[model samples]
Target: MDVNFSKQGDWTIIAVEGRMDTVSAPEFEKMVQERILQGSNRLIVDFSKLDYISSAGLRSILVAGKNSKAKGGELACCGLQGVVKKVFDVSGFHKLLPIFDSKEDVLNRE
Candidate 1:
């Protein structure tokens, strides 16, 4: 997947394209860690272009989310559709993670 990152105030927004599977999970994890290291606590992941995600991808995000929470920060996701949404649904990650219908929704809420 191709990942693009931007910032808004204290929040870091990431746009991910393509598939986030075993091959790309580590790369994404590295990006996330870099953002955290930059002192960005609030995170919003845009999955509008993401086509697929595997267990490894899910695990990496879960770990990142936990770290963000432990740091008293927040991590939100938006724009997931089709198979990507289904993956999170089946894994019960829809409930575990804070997901939004759109980027505006996440930005406006909390």
Candidate 2:
């Protein structure tokens, strides 16, 4: 998996590509941890190009979301589809996390 970082206002956007499996989940978690340590609280994870995600990936996302909430910020995900979306829904993460249809939707949220 490949992860890219960008910013808009106070929000840090993470665009992920490829498969987020056990091998890449740890890297993803580390990147988010580093960003949080650098004082980034608001986070948007873009999964438009993500083809697959394992349970480990979900766990990493859970950690990031919890971290964001603990800091009084927010973490949202966008562009989930197909198997990835199904996994999230079946795992009940759709209720646990804020999900949007697009990055613009997340940015525009109040």
Candidate 3:
């Protein structure tokens, strides 16, 4: 998987591409952790190009979300589709995580 990071205002936007499996999940987690340690609390995960995600990926996301929330910020995801959306829905993550239909929706929200 490929992870690209950018910043918009107080948000650290992470754009993920390809598959997020066991091997890649740790890398993803590491990147997020680094950002958090750098004092980046508000996060937006853009899964617009993500094709697949395993349970490990979900775990990583959960950890990142928790860390952000614990720091008095928030984490949100956008642009979910197909199998990825199905996984999230089936796993009940859609309810637990803040999900938006588009990046614009996330960016515009309070």
lDDT per residue (tens digit) for residues 1-110 in model 2: 99999999899999999999999999999999899988998999999999999999999999999998899888999999999999999999999999999999988875
**Pairs clashing within candidate 2:** none
- Sort every candidate by lDDT, greatest first: 2, 3, 1
Better of 1 and 3 by lDDT: 3
- Top of the candidates by lDDT: 2
CA lDDT of each prediction against the hidden true structure: 0.89, 0.94, 0.93
| lDDT (10s digit) by residue, model 1, range 1-110 | 89999987778898999989999999899889878877887899899999999999898889889878878897899998999999999999999989999988988886
Candidate 3 pairs with clashing backbones: none
TM-score of 2: 0.97
List where candidate 2 sits over 4 angstroms from the true fold: none
